[model samples]
Every structure is written in C-alpha cells, then in structure tokens.
Target: MRDLPDPGPWDEPEQAPPWRPEHGEKPRYRYWPQGHRPALQALVDGRWRTLQVHSRIDYPDGRVAYQGEIELPVEGRPAEHHHRAYWWPQPGRLRVAYGTDIAPT
Candidate 1:
C-alpha cells in the first residue's frame, strides 16, 4: 500500500462558513453534477496519466472537490496508489498530495 502524503494548502478556502452548513448538506455551487465521472491528468510514475473521478464532495459554501485512487507501477508491479485528491473545478486543476497539480484532460 502506497500511502500518499497529506495535501498542502488548498487553492481555495476549504472550510465552509458556519451559517452555510446549517442550511443543508447540498453544496451551493454545482460545477460538476453528482454522479458525473470526470477524467483528470496527474503525474504518476514520472509520467502524466489519466485518472478517473470516483466521488465528489461539496461544501455548503458552494465549493466542490473530487477524489479517487489510482493504480501505479511500483517495482515492476501494480500497486494501489492512494493520494490526498482534491479537485477544484473552478480552476480546472486537481491537486494531490503526491506533489503535483492535476488538470482536466
């Protein structure tokens, strides 16, 4: 198991305002609709590879982010690569704890 490191500072504010969450669990902003699978590019094994979006989380303050895991090659074998995935549709960039910024393909 390859555990990726924790993500760094988010490009946008991660926390929703106190009054926001009280309204409901639904995100105020909808960049990518729920159940939509978006493909993004990330740096894996020193090369850019396409990764599929597994799930998404929306903040009450209208912020949305995507996350998922990808299989990576390690020592000539495929290994589960877990990364702290955070997708910001506004910037059209995906940031992972693996030390690179992923972008929409």
Candidate 2:
C-alpha cells in the first residue's frame, strides 16, 4: 500500500477572479460554483443593475453572496462599478434570477 502525499492548500480554487487594487485583502477570490449561473442585480442609482458575477461566497450563516462588477454611465473615464449581493430569501438590496426565472429590465 502506498501512502498518499499531502495536498497543500488543496482547498484553494484553481482559478480566481481578477484582483482589483480597490478590493482589500479581506474579500479574497472565491470560485463561482458550476451549474449555478444565477444572474445577479443590485439597486444602483435607484434602479436595478445587472452585475457581472466574478465570485460566489457561501457564508457560514447559510447565506450565499456574490461579488462582481457592473458598468454604469458615470462622469469618468472608467465607469465600471463594484458591488456585492446576497441570494434571494436573504433580504438585501439585490435581486437574483435563476434559469428561466429572469425578470425584465
């Protein structure tokens, strides 16, 4: 019988979302789970804006959260906005749609 070698940091994801200078160390990159392509939206400037999900987090409190970027028309060269949202059933300033349950803009 052969002994298996220890896997260092095997829990880490193979790929991670791009790191932005604005994003501090605490909110590290997390992998978005497969087959869980839920469109996320956040209330921005009094309107719901769709987010380009970069990372997904499953909190210890049984709440799922998403962090991503959104492009909005701002008076600047870069109009990309960063935001986070929790999955539906968790009261938040965001909305989530799964499968064919998409909502109109």
Candidate 3:
C-alpha cells in the first residue's frame, strides 16, 4: 500500500475563522448608491485595494434593467475593465479611459 502525503498548514480547517462585517465595510473612494449597484473595498498588507464595482438597473416590475462590472488588476500598475449591459439607455457609448501616462494593455 502507498503512503499518503501529509497535508500542510493550509490543509487544516480554521480554528477561529475570519471575521466578516454584517453591513459591510467602508471604501476609500466614493461609491455609487446601493440601489444602483454593489461595491467592495479591502486592505491587504497595509495597501488599499478596490475589489469590485457592480451595479444594476431595475424595471417597474422589479426586473433587472441593466448590469455592469469594473475589474482591477492584481499586481504592478493598476488596470481597470468596465463592462455594462447592452440594453441600458445612455448618452455617447461607453468609453475606456486609463490614468494619465498609463498605456492600455
């Protein structure tokens, strides 16, 4: 019979587990209205991180009218991707803009 390898520290379950806020935490920058969308923020290793930005529009019947997502890069210079629903009404099509001196990847 073959001997099984032992699991490392990560393989063990949490004793106390992590704490998650009930009403969610605050963000560094201004966020959109709650009815408009969902936003997230976090601090890792003392550095601020913007996790996600999501939003939706609802119809009178309580159906999803529109949806959008904004994703950020994981490392190095920050990058963002903006995606939105095709049916939402807006002026001038959505445009992608990067910070000053940053080139699109």
Error of 3 at 77 (Å): 13
Arranged by lDDT, best first: 2, 1, 3
Local distance difference test values of all predictions, in order: 0.45, 0.47, 0.31
lDDT of 3 by residue, 13-52 (tens): 1111111354234212223454443433322233333323
Number of the top candidate by lDDT?
2
The estimated TM-scores of all candidates read 0.40, 0.44, 0.21
Q: Which ten residues in a row have the lowest lDDT in candidate 2?
A: 7-16
Candidate 1 pairs with clashing backbones:
none
Q: In terms of TM-score, which candidate is stronger, 1 or 2?
A: 2
Identify the candidate with maximal TM-score: 2
Worst 10 residues of 1 by lDDT: 10-19
Measured with C-alpha atoms, the lDDT of residue 104 in candidate 3 is 16
lDDT of 3: 0.31
Q: How many clashing residue pairs are found in candidate 3?
A: 0
TM-score of 1: 0.40
Error of 3 at 88 (Å): 14
* lDDT at position 39, candidate 2: 61
lDDT pick, better of 1 and 3: 1
